[model samples]
Target: MAQDIGRVHVIRHLIEKSRDRKIKKMIEKMMPILLVLAASVCIATTFGILFTLVFETFEFFQRVSIIEYFFGTEWYPFSSGNPSFGVLPLIMGTLKVTIIAMIVAVPFGLAVAIYLSEYASGRTRKFIKPVLEILAGVPTIVYGFFALTFVTPILQIFIPSLKLFNAISPGIVVGMMILPSIISLSEDAMNAVPNAIREGALALGATKLEVALKVVLPAAFSGIIASIVLAISRAIGETMIVTLAGGAMPSFDFSVTGSIQTMTAYIVQVSSGDAGYGTVIYYSMYAVGFTLFIFTLLMNFIAHKISKRFREEY
Candidate 1:
């Protein structure tokens, strides 16, 4: 009876091992299919958005003159009799805010990144990095309100000409909003430089700052530029901050103190029940959105080209 029990246990063990192998093989086969399905979903969603934007924008151009829309300086889509659809003013407003944001974000972010990557102790970096990332996660609407209420008031004391709802305040807030992207990406890029290069520079009598600036900065140049480009894209696409703080008036003026409207702000305004469905104003939103998309796409393309051209291999 004991011999018979041992034989039976051996047989059951072999069966369980075979069943485990079959389950493992089934999982391996299913993984590829699951990954492909996920990719397909993303691709389908992108195409759906593109199709919607293109069709509506094409219809808008049929009704409105494309030449006027592109080149005209005025943008009064709500005008009772002759609603001018010149997109130039909106473009200028966007550029003004973007330029201001870049000016504020680049220097401060780069400085923080350099310090974090090259100078900070591990414990300090661990604490500060999370704080910076948390800043990035703060709701943009909160930034807008902060710009509208707090920053604007502070600026008014320094620049009496600054309007309550102007480009400068929101631009500064937007800069703060995008600071984490610059800091995190630039720091990562700087850290990716080989320690051997730093050691060699140090052995040659270079100071810590010198090695960081000359060796690491050059090696990470592409990444820093890419981060800046990404920040610019984020600034361009930001809506709530500009809409709430930058005012609703679309102006051709480039003054930072004056009120102006960005493309995203205009979209929000029209979509807020002011423009009826299927109206020209409604359709114009798609045109502006497409234009914004083109700008961001162009920036991304440039970033990709720059990274490819200047990427350094270890």
Candidate 2:
């Protein structure tokens, strides 16, 4: 009887071990599928939101002509009187901020990246990198306040034509906000350049600046372009800075010194408390959002193309 009991215990232990091994193997086999599902979640969510926006936008356009939505010159959806739904001024406003931010961010960001990658020592790079990228972590509202309270006053002195809530201050602050992304991504790309390439350039008597600008930058150009496009996308979508620093005036003008409102700012304005749900004005928000979605989607596609177009494994 005792021998039979001992044999039964041994069998139970073996069975438990076998079960555990099978479970582990099953999980291992499912790992890739699980990762793919996780990736697909983002795509699914994006499509879902896009579908919702399109459905709502189509409904809005049914009430207002598509031509008026796309080409009309005025946007007064909340006006008590006749309300117009023209998106051109909003598009222009978004373009103005984006262009100014790019103009400020591109050269400055590339310069900083080059200096950090080529000239800065270990300690300097360590100290400066975090401090610079820290700006990215700061809230957009805080930057908005800085733009309005701090930068605007200074600009008013230099360009007296600049209004209290002009586009220039917000654009400049957005550029500063965008700087961290450009620097970090550009630095990563520059660092990824083969050290052998740098060595060859130096062996040929090229200066550090020459190697950076001519050799490393050209090699990392695709990544730099991706970073710039992504930065511009962020600038176009930014809300708090532009809403606070840029006045609520939507105009067809492009002057940075003048007050203007971006698409994002207008969306924020409408969604916050312009009208009740199911109203034409309320539906206009979705139309604007859909337009923004298409713009950003195109930008993402371009960035993807640029990145995939070239590969240097060495």
Candidate 3:
């Protein structure tokens, strides 16, 4: 009887050991699969948002004529008979704001970045960097008001045709809005450059300016250019400032003195008033927004490619 009990205990112990090993193996295998599942969920979420935009845009296009949507000269939704859906004017307006913003932001932001990275002392940098970033944190509506009430009047002094909601005012304000992004990003790139590289240039008797302009700047060119592109994207997608300060006229004229409508401004225009969802006017908003999203996405892709291509390995 004692021998029988011993044999039974041995069998139970072997079964328990096998079960534990199988459970351990299963857990180990599942961990990697779980990680993959988490990553897939994140990617799916991103694609889902994009898919929502695309699907709505498709619905919009099904109702509206593509020719009218893209090439129509006027964008008066509530005006009398057949509404003209030419999106060219809005595209032109968006380009005007983006170009003006780049013009304003690039030079000043780069200069600030150069100063902060190459010239400023640690103490000065500590003081100035935060202040510059504070510009980024300021509400866009405040900038819009500033442009409307302050900058527009100032611009009118130099150019008489500048209106209350001219492209110039909003463009400048949008530039200001993106300036911090450019400055902060460019400064980070410049700072990332190896100290040894700077020191080597200096050792060769190059002036600080020469080292900065020739060596450091070129080395960090990818990052600087990426920053500029990002700034342009921000300018292109700006909503509140352009909507508030820019005139809603969808004119094809490239003049900064006139009020022009941007894509975002148009979106705001369509979404704000009495346009009900599922209507042609309301659906048009999705189409326009999808176009704008594509533009920004392309810009981001270009920036990413440039950054990846030119990334320096230390």
* lDDT (Cα atoms) of all candidates against the true structure: 0.92, 0.89, 0.89
Tens digits of per-residue lDDT, candidate 2, 1-314, equal: 99999999999999999999999999999998999999999999988998899999988988999999899999877777898999998998889888888888999999999999999999999899789868889999999999999999999999999999888888889999999999998888889898999999999999988999899999999989988988988998899999999988888876778889888998898888757888998889999998988888888788778766635433
How does each model score on TM-score? Answer: 0.88, 0.88, 0.85
lDDT of 1 by residue, 26-133 (tens): 999999999999999999998998998999999899889999999999999999998999999999999999999999999999999999998999999999988997
For candidate 3, lDDT tens digit of each residue in 199-232?
A: 9999999999999999999999999999999888
What is candidate 3's local distance difference test score?
0.89
Q: Is candidate 1 or candidate 2 better by lDDT?
A: 1
If ranked by lDDT, best first, what sequence of candidates would result?
1, 2, 3
Find the number of clashing residue pairs for candidate 1: 0
**In model 3, which regions exceed 4 Å deviation?**
1-44
Worst 10 residues of 3 by lDDT: 305-314
Model 1 regions more than 4 Å off: 1-35, 309-312
